[model samples]
Target: MTTTPALETVGITKSYGSHSVLRGVDLAVPAGSVVALLGSNGAGKTTLVRILSTLLRADGGTASVNGHDVATQPGAVRESISLTGQFAAVDEVLTGRENLVLVAQLRHLEDPGGTADGLLARFGLSDAGSRRVATYSGGMRRRLDIAMSLIGDPPVLFLDEPTTGLDPQSRIEVWRTVRELAGRGTTVLLTTQYLDEAEQLADRIAILHEGRILTDGTLAELKQLLPPSRVEYVEKQPTLEDVFLALVGHDTTAT
Candidate 1:
């Protein structure tokens, strides 16, 4: 018998009025693997995520998380999954510690304070936990937002553009966190525009274009689809990111 994937979708489609957002897309993510969904801004990445996470309904097709149908078994799907949206959703007026404590209490986890403290420390925000989130740097707030999602230890996670405003160092910190989570058998589906981030974290990568998947495969498998490189006569040049940053003047002095 074939095992159900940790996350699976067959011919998933969505539309906003007359504007089609997803056009019969299909994907399957295996247990304990990180799959990156990549697309340009309006390629239906967020729309697909919303449907799978049960925040929105698919206009067509079927999706399941941990063997539960997202359309008919939303509660079961929710019990097994967590989503960190593009924006930081923490309460600006609350302290970092308070935000975590609130989620812990709502989840009815015992010893909320200890749990909050542990998470704060894990995210390297222990010293700043008492400060109101209004005073946090963008990276700090982003870290706290992710920590809040980990409170219940959900087996599946959907991170939608999770590191958008973070600094380079904080981005690496979150990458390590994701690697550890997958190592512990948690499945992760990440939607991102950052090519290198996907290269670093994803065991498999899927690209969405015009509401359908362009390709979905392991990095090596995907690379094989490209035209083989011609023999190089000169040393390889610097990457476009290096040239862009140098030309645009990346501010090391600012966070």
Candidate 2:
């Protein structure tokens, strides 16, 4: 028999005062796969993550994480999922190791120290484990936050723009880590404005616009939503640079 989806949201809607953020949004994430939520700013990506992580309630509709209703079974949902927000949630005053230990302890895990050590080593933060998080670089702090999120070994992870402000190398490192997590049977729901990131990591891609899913499918499928790719042959063909400038009015080669 097929296993149940790791996450599901049906007709989820949320409003703040007079403004509606999510308008009957629906999503499903299978275990051991990456589901990328792509959208422009204000498309409700963060709001959806908050609802799924049980940090906020949906104004209407229902959501479930690993078969537990988010509204009625929030504790069970929390037990099965972890969330890493756009900002690194590390405590700047605490050491990297201290942060992991604190998370493990809060999860009520036995041998929090051993767990912290293992995570530090896994995330390549072992050498800096004793240093205060304030001294770490952006990438290191992001890694530490992700490691802390894994203290409970959750079955599902919610990454909300986890690499928002990193350099290219650091972003690649985080991507590798995300792929590794999904490979280990952890379902991942990733939200990002980066189209390339979504294409690289998502098994399925969903684009949100105006608080609704405009389209959802595989990379090839999403590309199909755009005009068909054109092939041209020339002695000295226009490069992607020239094409980008012609279409989008940005000169990629200009300093």
Candidate 3:
């Protein structure tokens, strides 16, 4: 049997007056997989995501999340997905655990406290669960923000440049978290400008340019679009990240 896409959009169009933000965009994401919407700033990545998440209505075209139409069944669409924006949205005044508990309670889930505790441990935030969010590092705050998004266990996740301003180490931390989430079978639609991030996480990468999808394929497939480079051998050198991690005594391979 064929499986329907976990998320999909067809001819999705949006604009601000005459300045179009998205033009006839078509994309599909398979269940329990990660698809990166790769684009630079002003490429309409966020606009597409907002439309998919039902946060903004498209000027034209149809979109769906977990089988629910974004336009006709917006409530169901919203119920089936979670959105994490460019920056952490955690309440600085609340403790990490408190933030999770608040979302669980708002969702009317059973045993909110238990749910909070479980998520804290799941996100590796148990030790800091009692600390106010204001005290957490950028990575920790981002992690907690993501944990809160999981309260309802939405099957489709929309991450809009999740690691935008994070330092290298913190970016790696978020990368590890995304990998873990995908491993647990969540369908993720990640929008990012970082080519390395897409290479590291996406099963398939879709390049959006000038309000349209310019290309879509696996990394290997995309690379084929360019002529092969002449073979050469040189002494291997560590990247700056490698040197920095070494100086800091951090295990580059560690999650």
Cα RMSD (angstroms) for every candidate in the order listed = 3.7, 6.1, 2.1
Instruction: Evaluate residue 81 in candidate 3 and report its C-alpha lDDT on the 0 to 100 scale.
Output: 89
Model 3 lDDT per residue over 155-187, tens place: 989899999998787888889989999999999
List candidate 2 segments past 4 Å from native. 1-3, 233-255
2 against 3, candidate with superior TM-score: 3
User: What are the lDDT figures for the candidates, one per model?
Assistant: 0.88, 0.87, 0.90
lDDT of candidate 1 vs native?
0.88
Candidate number with the higher lDDT (1 or 3)? 3
Off by over 4 Å in 1: 1-4, 231-255
Segments of candidate 3 deviating more than 4 angstroms: 1-3, 251-255
Tens-digit lDDT track for model 1 on 1-255?
113489999999999889999999999998888999999999999999999999999999999999999999999999898899988899999999999999999999989999999998787789898999999877777778888998888988999998987766557667877887778788899999999999999989999999999999989999999899787689889987567667756542222
Model 3: lDDT to the true structure? 0.90
Error of 1 at 14 (Å): 0.9
